[model samples]
Target: MTLEISRLLELTTWRVFDVADDGRVLAGCDESGSVQLVELAEGGCTELTALAGAVVGRYLPGERAVVVQHDSDGDERGQLSLLRLDDRRSRPAPLSELEPLVRDSEHVHRLLDVLPGRIVYATNRRNGVDFDVVIRSVTTGEEHVVHDGGGMVAEVAISPDSRFAAITVPATKPLSDQVLVADTMPETGADQLRELTDRDLAARHLHPGWQPGGLVVTTDAGRDRTGVARLDPRTGGHHWLVTSDEHDLSGRLSPNGRTLLVLTAVDGAHRAALHEAATGEHVVDIALPSGGWCGYPLPEPVWSPDSRFAALSFSSPSTPGDVLLVDTATGTCTPLTSSAAQLAEETLVEPTVHRVPARDGEQIPCFRYAPAAPDGSAVLLIHGGPESQSVRSFHPLVQAMVSRGHTVLVPNVRGSTGYGKRWYSADDARNRLESVQDLADLHRWLPSVGLDPSRAALWGGSYGGYMVLAGLAFQPELWAAGVDVVGISSLVTFLENTAPYRRAHREREYGSLIADADFLREASPLNRASAIAAPLFVLHGANDPRVPLTEAEQIVEAVRANGVAYEFHVYPDEGHGLAKRANRLDAYPKALAFLSRHLG
Candidate 1:
């Protein structure tokens, strides 16, 4: 049963956004060849919004209307819209029923929390660089600015009484953040903002939610690994609620504040459990798929109003993304949505986790997917976000390559999360190339793991794409070919041309342009393009806000000057990555064909 690459690419994926009291679910699915919003009920899945790119949403208190955030093309400037729901009618409603809520095309807006009469969000409309957290009334459209202390606002939460708000903002260093609290009502003289955590510590705080006693957040401030803690708003002190030595811990509280859904990151996989919120007592460990992704994208484990049940999105190599319904009392997880499109789960390959030793005695964790019938070649797939980890998730490109008989190795180099704070900050600032050194070590160790060193190619997107180009340019003879999607060629040009809101945040990890210009130029692949002698394929979105299209154009021009074999493609409607299925179906197959010809 050999399936075509198109068939493998056709596999649909979904993400759960919110769950209603009556067991209805709000989700994002790619069944329409593009990511769109849909409502999951007993009758059937009904499309809610037909907007472009990807859409994320939540049920406004009553479940009669939903507040959705969507961006045009791939520009990343999100706009908020309200979709009026009438579940009584039965048939799917038209896309024209949406009402614009907060749409400012010049700036970015992100929805943080939704309540009965208002919604909390972070927007950079104030000055276009600093994000301000605002609570706006759903009926009157009145806005109340809570915290505007000048930094990228990550997460925000409203108190149970709707009087106080808590937010997480960047601290003095990279990968470190602090939580702040402020009154949501401007009429109250107590609206003055105050820090909720120690300002001198270098810890990263996230997932701020109000409990009866204090603010519940996950931080690694005074510890090596992240753990759940309760921060006292008045005293600026904290105490541990959930702590683990072997893994990073994060949790979300139920609406009633009685139960906490905690997720633990074990290497690249996840483990979930229910705990008593008051005493932090473990209730029951929920059984989950062996290798599946359950953490990330902010919203997961959306609980019902009564806190009896929760919905979480799960995905892995063999399973396409789907929402799972979890019962807290019995610890039962039932599938709520299916996007397999009639494909057999057994046909897909499952990866085996391994720890590859680096040259400096450091062990790098990776997932290897081996095809039943080998084509004598391999592809090293690198993940983006030197800050992000490559976990067990459904990747269309990885599956497509396996179906074509190519073994794939996905590694999490130093500076990737899910490990620990120490591991993630290893390659920061002056130590940038140390992460690239791990790539060289992996290339050398490939033969020991039943892979052909001479027939291997490099594949990645964004920062992963930068790794591909760096490997080819820095260690020219190691790879057969390289496929770079929206990769940075020159750190100097990247910092200069990237979106203003993202520049400072990215510079903290990749070194500053003003202080480390010479080092940045020397590390750029575009500086040594002549060193690349292998065939290459470069793909980028013309509207990419993070890494501009100039990145692709300059690299292509440099490689062309050296007479290197290469293919360059630019998607006018795409940004950082391919968000549309039609574009992915077209781009990935060509890239695979290029790898096939070069590897042969």
Candidate 2:
């Protein structure tokens, strides 16, 4: 069952991020950036090979021909390449030779902000936690460090005037991340600096992006409704743009400082609302399907450079997500990218949005996928992000099941964000039971909506996979069969037994092992093994860093011990999700066989 070291290494690395510039949708083959260039009119995608891991420079407007990319996956020892779009005409940019100062450096995150003359990025070595913000110049090619040390920096906002840049810093030290504030652009000397926390701020803030006068910060009042605060970095002065004790406010400050957009279920449901930054008056609201992503829904709502149109999308469970263009000027909406249009209309299943009330009366949002009535059997599709929201996106997987005559249900449980901060906060610490109840309530409702509950299947990945095991043991009668992909069987053991390096984030997201011992034990699926009541299929990668390989082994052992109907699959050469084409190809068939036998 153990994989040789070489085979495991092959699966860990990927080869084809580089494609020819023909520009069709390209497959994401590896940690190296993958991109798909599609010809909209014809639906033909030309792939530009030789492109790096990320689509770097925006091509000439309207050229639409090729994409240029950079391979950022290369660390200090890996191949650091800056590849151009489909050709060797342009010179390749040399990725820094610096050894990766951090693992998933993108996790602690190495962000690079490019202004006309200056560039800023984080210098982090692989497998290391400590980080520093470093800056380089485009015109002159000079490099320097901005921050001395790091804790998890994100939302790197470069001020328009380029006179200063704003960054949000939070470290583990006492009073370190307590009051949110802004730091100035670093100069050659560390001695010359400005810190804005002295200005007096309230609440532990997040998502600190720049506005006209200062940076906008989102905060909750002692774990309640979130409010918006704008601080003038220069003067250490502040203003509360909008405050609500009941409905949490979500703000996305547009690129230009003139318009500030706020959202909170404006459509009788959570929807996107625009506001004037200076007056704090509501400007306009965009409608969304009831119970969808709360803020800037219809898509991420990209404000055109001129601030004229808000480009986004609105999606539901049954319906494939559609890209949209909203006119910020006239409030007109247009569907630009319709993934559903690619499919035949008669075969389309409509997604109904509703939240199942849990034991605590908390509404966990769920998308119910209803197929035609001839076949009432359906599958419950749970999303992984105990911290993520299940929004309307084009999921080829969901569509495939629908094509095979199966209904799919996706639930954004207690841990999901965008239902306001409270919904996400409710899932913290010892609230794992609430999340489990959220799924139970959702499943209990399936039979009422034409689905034959006795014939349903439980399928999920990551946290969703964790929910699968929890479902079988906690609520066995809900499904006939179940599928789990890279799920943690026990929180207590996962914290104590997994890779020491990844435990840092695992502790922060789930709960600290030492501090929340009792809760971790209760949250583990392994603790309730005898309760499993359905056939199960568990799949995991042999070299996964986050969940590690042992989680699957331990849980599978328990499944075997109880003599439950189960099958265990570990992709030896693949880590996390399958990266090798053959391994991924092999998984589809194995899943088909397992589901057919169990769901039948």
Candidate 3:
């Protein structure tokens, strides 16, 4: 039953982005750009007709969600708008009969907050007041910015009491810099006044919130910048509420100050250990099926009203997300949702662990899936985030490979999160080479576990793509083929060409481009394409906001010039992921054919 290229596309989901306040009520803007709300109230029904074309931003109360909608026209985002039920019994009504906002091209709406009674919130992002505080009084329909700062208004936060507002900024751009805070919309604006700074600029920190008495934050305070602390909002004093010998203490107080949770790395993935809020004491550590939990835990675990259980959605790279309810009293984990249905009829081959040793002797942890088929070959699947993990999961992609007689191995190399902050911080400016070598070791080490060494190939997107090139460059014969899906060819060019929004975060994860430019160049795959050993396949989405198309093009150009065997595919309508069904079906089979030709 060989499937045609066109048939694969038909099986893919042509799902659009459905935005809802919570997970329950869903609404979608179809290709025509009309916002149609899903009707689950009357029955499992969906209507074809409703509201205007393309919402830049839409909010429905009880449906309580506010998301930044992507703009179609220019670089500018749109004006913030609120939609709600007239009486909580009927369909959502636009806050004002006035037309949905069409933001002037010059002004882009970056922040939005929705309040009751059409009291929509906005940040005048263009002005230094990026944190626009447009408070619409219920009695009067007037609107305005409350606390107009002179610098960029990064974000706006409303207190639970609904009586207070605050604006936050990075203080200044480079992540090592201090965090700045200012209060917004006060009765007098005096009691709300406070400024906080730090002298130990090297210490890691994050400004979580400001409570009635002071500010509560998570930071690597005493333990190499690896613990959470509560700080005096005015005086800049701080102390850790919970501290561990290992620097994994995280999760902070919620808006209401009722609950707190911390994620600590254990043997596998990370264990989400809960804490009691009133006194900040250890309550229970959540468990996963084979052992460790998955995904990055939240600032606060989902809590039941009766304080009985906390809900968490977890997955490993081998596992997709499965919601779980943990009993606070007994610390027993219960799956709220059943395990993922067998993927495409493949047996659920659980992943096993192995440590890939780097040149530096630091071990890289990996999850390897043994194929049920005796095809006598393995496939190495790498993850992007260099900062994220594969997690335990029932991923369809992995299943597809396993069903096709391939063993898949995902290595959580240096810079992966949930291993503790420092392990993640290890892949900074001076250490990119270490991360690259980790993958090379995995390709060399696969056969010790019964995985055939000669037929292995490297597959990844984004940083994972970067891994493919790095592997080919470092150990050409180690892998039979390579697939670089939107990977960076030159780290230097990636930094130089990245958009303004990514500059700050990238600086935190990577070193300052100005200071460590040489490091980026030294580790770049373009520099070593001459040494590449395998046939390569590359793909890029035209509209990707994260890794731009230039990354793929540069690598392809270099690979071609080097006379390396390769094929390149481009999709015009996709972003970072294959959102459209047509594009994925076209890409995967093309990739499969390319791999099949070379790997054999």
Which candidate leads the pack in lDDT?
Answer: 1
lDDT of each residue in 1-600, candidate 1, tens digit only: 455677767777778898888778888888778778888887778888776677789999875889988888899998888888876655533345677778999999999889887788999999999898888888899898888888788888888888888888877677777788887676766647888776556788987777888888888867888988888778867788899988998888887877888889987778889988888889999887657554653246688767888888887666778888788878898777765545654377778888999988899998888888877688989888888888777776787788777889989998889988989989888887888888888888888877789999999999999999999999998989999999999999999999988888888778899999999998999998989999999999998999999999999999999899999988898999998888988898899889989988
In model 3, the Cα lDDT at residue 292 comes to: 54
TM-score of 1: 0.96
TM-scores for the candidates: 0.96, 0.73, 0.76
Question: What's model 1's overall lDDT?
Answer: 0.84
Among these predictions, the greatest TM-score belongs to 1
Q: 1-600 in candidate 3: lDDT tens per residue?
A: 232434323321111222232232233322232333332222433432233323333343334333323333222334544333333444343334323433444455553444444343444445522444456543355665565544434445455565555444443323332444444445554654445655335444553654565555566644543566666666767756776775356564544465566666553456677675545688776676654555442112344323455555555543444455566567787664433432364245677777777667778878877765547677788788776666655455665666566778877888775455566767766777777777767766766777678898989988888888888887776878999888888787787776555554566556678888777778888888788868889988776666778988877887788787889888776666564555666788888778768666
Q: Indicate whether candidate 1 or candidate 2 has the larger lDDT.
A: 1
Better by lDDT, candidate 3 or 2: 3
Residue 279, model 1: Cα distance from true site in angstroms: 1.7
Cα RMSD (Å) per model?
A: 1.8, 7.8, 5.9
lDDT of residue 224 for candidate 3: 47
TM-score of 2: 0.73
Candidate 1: Cα lDDT at 569? 86
lDDT of 2 at 347: 48
Q: What is the lDDT of candidate 3?
A: 0.58
